[model samples]
Target: MKSFKRKAKIYLPLLMVGAVIGLLFTNCSKQGFDAAVAEIQKGDDPFLGYAWHINNTGQSVFATSGSGVVGFDLNMLKAWTSGLSGSGLKIVVSDDGIQDAHEDLKDNFLYGVSINYHLSTPTGANNAPPNSVDDNHGTAVAGLIAAVGGNGVGTKGIAYKSKLIAYNLLSSNVAQLDERIGQQVTGGYDIYNMSWGSSQNNLPVPVAVWGTSLVAGVTNGRAGKGSIYVKSAGNDFIVKCHNSTTTYCVGNANFDPDNNMPYTLMTGALNSMGEVASYSSPGANLWVSSFGGEFGDDYPAMITTDRSGCSAGYAQTLNSGKVEFERGSDGNSKCNYTTTFNGTSAAAPVLAGAIALILEANPNLTWRDVKYILAKTAVQVSPNMSNVTRHPFYNYPGDASKNVRLPTGAIWENAWVTNAAGFKFHNWFGFGRVNVDAAVALARNYSSPYTAGPSVIGFLMNSSPSPNAIPDYDAAGISSTLSVGTSLRIEAVQVQINISHNNIADLGIELISPSGTKSMIVNMRNSLTGIAGFDNDIFLSNAFFHERSNGTWTLKVYDGASNDITGTLNSWGVKIIGTP
Candidate 1:
């Protein structure tokens, strides 16, 4: 089934039962875990005394009792902690900077290894400036992954014992990003979590130089086993705001090129209701979803460590410049913790923590193996109702004169595609919500597909090329085909397109595999109004995961705009990577 145009929503009746049972077991196990954690001495960590997300026992010391409405299912965590707490695994947070000296984080910090790439004389120290506004971001991200657990002080991280290395790349340029990533990979870090990116719909498409660097890192890093890179799918979502009678619109996620990189595990965000977060970006590029909380008073946000001194952090904003604190019976601020961390930023680290657990369970698994296991074991959550509307600036030729109204009904439903091998995939929720327990168990007993022999090694199995003119203002676009004679298990597909146009943002591109699985390479990016067009830019897609590579593959390019600006498809090609 074509992903975008379909209305198939797979609703699992068993999920409701499973959620109920999961909650019951979580509550029952909380008491034991609580007592176990209380025995450890936590110097000043207040939230760990009674955090709802960590304990799930309705005994939170804070004002908001999130109970069951604001936490990742702790059953998985409880099961994971029983056997492992990521004892030896390492995760590097590449962001603004991490407050390594924060009480909750000092224990797990890997000093002398973290680096500040933006510095002229890059140092091992990765702590943010003492009182900088941007310093809290990395601190919050680090706390989510490896803040010390059972300390009786602060909240516990997903993998509280995992070692953390911070790399400050906030002010570094694109070239520096690759350089620092290289350092992490070579430093034996098991996983890297990047929770920041340029705005998804911003103008001027990014070049593929950084993408090439990422490909090289995955191919050569970690002693050739490859380092795991977990990235946050952008938070840009096309929303309509009606002020009185006038309406203002925004951008979509399909244009986020960073998430489209196949080498990284791009994650989206889910709220307390297990639904897509209002700001979480959506597209075929999303690999998975994780709990990152939601907006509004009814839905509690995620709670994590903030910058020291409470000078700049999420809680400060909530309390009107004062640090958010747990109130005692006397109505006085007692323990300090911030419950304002949200967005895909928070979701990425959650997934990174899960990866740390997986690595701790089975460190021998290759990077691809981790991806395979995550795709296999994720819990398929409910569908996210989406509305696909025409770009306001570039309506289809025939519909140019019609008034553009907000789209209604569900235009995109998260549907499952069961491949011949029984592997299920989805464009929206990815394989689904992360299940740490299931993933850990699977990892302990998993075997790599590439371990069999050379026959299973991923290689370029086929290719098709085309250099022709693409039709503008026409639904019937240009197409090029490539034929494969031998059957092969497909792992990834790469498409390269070169074009020249007055306004390249008006273009829409797609690729159809031999099995008729259509992957949308580029949706009309109305936000990119630059006159420059694509020049041999490469786009990657995993939509046809596991499909046999032995048929005619077609690349289609078209411009849906009726405006004076038009473009010609200079050249296009398809490369299928897999084992024969």
Candidate 2:
């Protein structure tokens, strides 16, 4: 383990001075303008200009003073000014296209590294110009992670000093995504931020082909250490739907399986108040949460760079249904910026920026090392009893509610689970929100558990084939058990289930370890109405982190829907991968 005493010695003075400056600025409310000007003159960060979440104390003074923003309490900006900025790291944003020429993003842009895969013959250069309708999304995402800081211009980025490479992979073509992943691996990019995914209710199940390609990329990317993939959990939780004639809402975040892979770091969104964003997805796959503001009369969304002229973003749409261009002091049309960027799209980049800082603090840390430090240091917040429910679609009556019961008299609580060895986890918020100070500190001293030898040799522990039929609308369905013969420190758990049903979304699968810790592998995706059930589809979970592999592990497959949708547990198996 790294020495905390040595780390404290280097950063204590900087933290103390920053706190004093923060307090001084906080007390002199009237001099806020003068303080900002002085900071600009001293080449300090000017994030306080438009970022209201920094000091948002209440709804009344939201844009002025509060402790709710993502990086405020963590002192991430102070770390940036103290020379922990991502100077040598490379970050790539795989999205529609980025406006590399935006005043806030131009300086850190990596020339010749960007590619436009959307073109007929995918070119090497990023020719997607600014002010186009499709250019704003990537530009905003890039700005959150690598927009230039302390430049006396627009808002600052998380790792403003990091180099950015933009790839225009606009299509959902699996080949295009695989090609981009290949480029990131071969091109030596350290981190890849993906803030977009498939739309809600559209193929609400995981695609096996996509999952295989993603696993390969992450396992072999970054010259063997593996490139860090930061992905958004999605924004489908806000949609409302009904089964047949019953009314219900779709908040089961598990519907979007693109982020359920083990190698990727899945990020969810939190509002300024540190509460889960209404639209952010929830599931066991979520690894961490970050600030992606709420949209309403009281809550404001994220503020980032936008395309120039009068042809970009929601600001233009809100301005009399046309793109409206803001003019500078020189009376010339200028690039527009908006505070309407919300959802997991904005949250993923926030974590990516923080990851750059971690890499900058300790470049030797591996991809798994980063995940470990994040899981260990993330701060738990907002312990509401919302997650403890019968089912995600608990509002619906009849078939949905009959099979979605939790035992007989059991009540669910959104509680934090700390394993025997001390790793923490939460379903809705993952390991809670990211704490830059703690993550960076841990990263600096992190010693990889697999460093003693080659990466921990992962072997399949046991497998149980279930050929039994699962009854429809039955709370007590078919289960298979696998007994472990050897003791092992579990890291990743892979479950493959095969079933045949009209609506696979009505199935809820759970993995009960020998210790009785239940992991919801597949939740009831009400939006998925396809007849194709889980046909040898693999689902990975790290929720069982730090558990001892012994005794009999149970796999329960319950069919939660009625109305002629029935399935058989054709065959199910579990692969335990870890060190012994």
Candidate 3:
């Protein structure tokens, strides 16, 4: 409706794999190894082909200011972040509650909540105790979600316009965390990163009430104006098949991917092999996978910041300094301390951070809108792969229906994008790999049926206005400007005929816009509201009107059903008869 999006260069995070370094060399080499440019690897990883997308694409469009996280492409991240920063968004961090703010957070945090109970007496702010040890996790989470870029320091974030409002929500006890969330319905954080989910071994409620609270936090976030809660789909790593809420750590108590719930997103971890990590949780409810390769499964180059002392389990960070994760921080003989780590917990926040970047770019997006953009925007690793591959036994009469083909990946005879072996939507790989270009394109190309004008709007009644409507119209018929805007929907219904019109029933009404752009108003199936009585009228059902953006409009009604089809307009009444 309005071009208000912050200029954003959404850069995806550098790919981290716990797999063999040799594989990294191989994957990296695949770029130089491209003889014909295989589609399997779009190779948008800039390091291989073009210079970092930051310098190549959107440097001019955006101000190159700050950065933030988002579940999208790095090049797009470069574009998305720079643009948003140009739009004036700062950064904030929520490192282990109020007082224990870390370096990545300190001055960056925003205080959207002002509850007095948590405020420090002297400072007039909620200066909670500086539980430093556990602050690393939150700081790391902060960095990934909204790290400032181009400072010659750390990596940049996905969105530059996003500002952080860090409020640590981890509790020493799950119940307390849940209660606190209940109190902080607005959850303070525009993006709540719950990196830690209790093991099913520990069950305090019939179902995980904490997970419920997290979802509730997202709901409240929507109410709070603009917020998106991203939670790690837990580290259980099981094939979560059914959707149920049983007594124990219920198996199917999750959203169905085939039937996604209204709100909330659950992600899985993609190991370097591009296969679902054995440790990654699975089910029809799974949305997408983030990089969380097991130690040595992909990039062993990562450093998980240890926040053993803070209350909120962790805030993801760059494994460094006073806030570094020591080799022996676990206080146990079995801590498995190494740079190589694998857990859905590690991947979820990265995805969540990306969501934050998206929200920053488009603050008007509702949770549903956000979900739609993300899903619709994701580019399947292999756009032609399938999810399930049925063997010959499962084949009926040995025929496959294109309409009923399995999802993007995992198909019987993979023939969509041939030569590009492998199904992308396998049970393991949700919907191919997350392609940044595809996702952002989806967002940019999105055009909802938002009404552009108000009542009494003029329907120019012409394909392209001319001397017939306006004098001296055109030398090049393809391009012309009439009124220059489509609004004030010319309200009414008229008859429309089919393309197969060797018959006399060829009748219809043209919905000409103020700009002379025409959309035909025809009779069709009347399904729902604001549409029951106007079956044959110009319908604005999908018209997602921008609150107060639609301007005045006009309509040119005509007779098409059973008449000469030329005279039902009220232009004179709307203002055409010399002030009559």
- State which candidate has the highest TM-score: 2
TM-score of each: 0.76, 0.79, 0.46
What are the per-model C-alpha RMSD values against the true structure?
A: 8.8, 9.8, 18.5
Q: Cα miss at 38, model 1 (Å)?
A: 13
Cα error of candidate 2 at position 5, Å? 50
Worst 10 residues of 3 by lDDT: 1-10
Please give the range of 10 consecutive residues that has the lowest summed lDDT in model 2: 6-15
Q: Using lDDT as the measure, what is the rank order of every candidate, best first?
A: 2, 1, 3
Model 2 pairs whose backbones collide: 55-65, 55-66, 56-65, 56-66, 57-65, 57-66
| lDDT values, one for every candidate | 0.60, 0.61, 0.33
At residue 499, what lDDT does model 3 achieve? 23
Tens digits of lDDT, candidate 3, 1-580: 0000012111112222212111211132323213212221121321111111122221111111211111212335343435544223432232244332433233445554422223443122444333434333444454444544443223343443355554443421112334443333244345555454433211122223433554565456555444555545544432211222221111111211111222345566654333444454333334455655443322222223223332323322333322122223322112212233335655655566566556555665655455546544544533444422432113233333211222122222221221111222222334334444445555555653322211333333333222222111111111122331332222221211112111111122223323223322221100010111111122221111111213322333221122221111212111110000
Candidate 1 displacement at residue 138 in angstroms: 0.1
Clashes of 3: 84
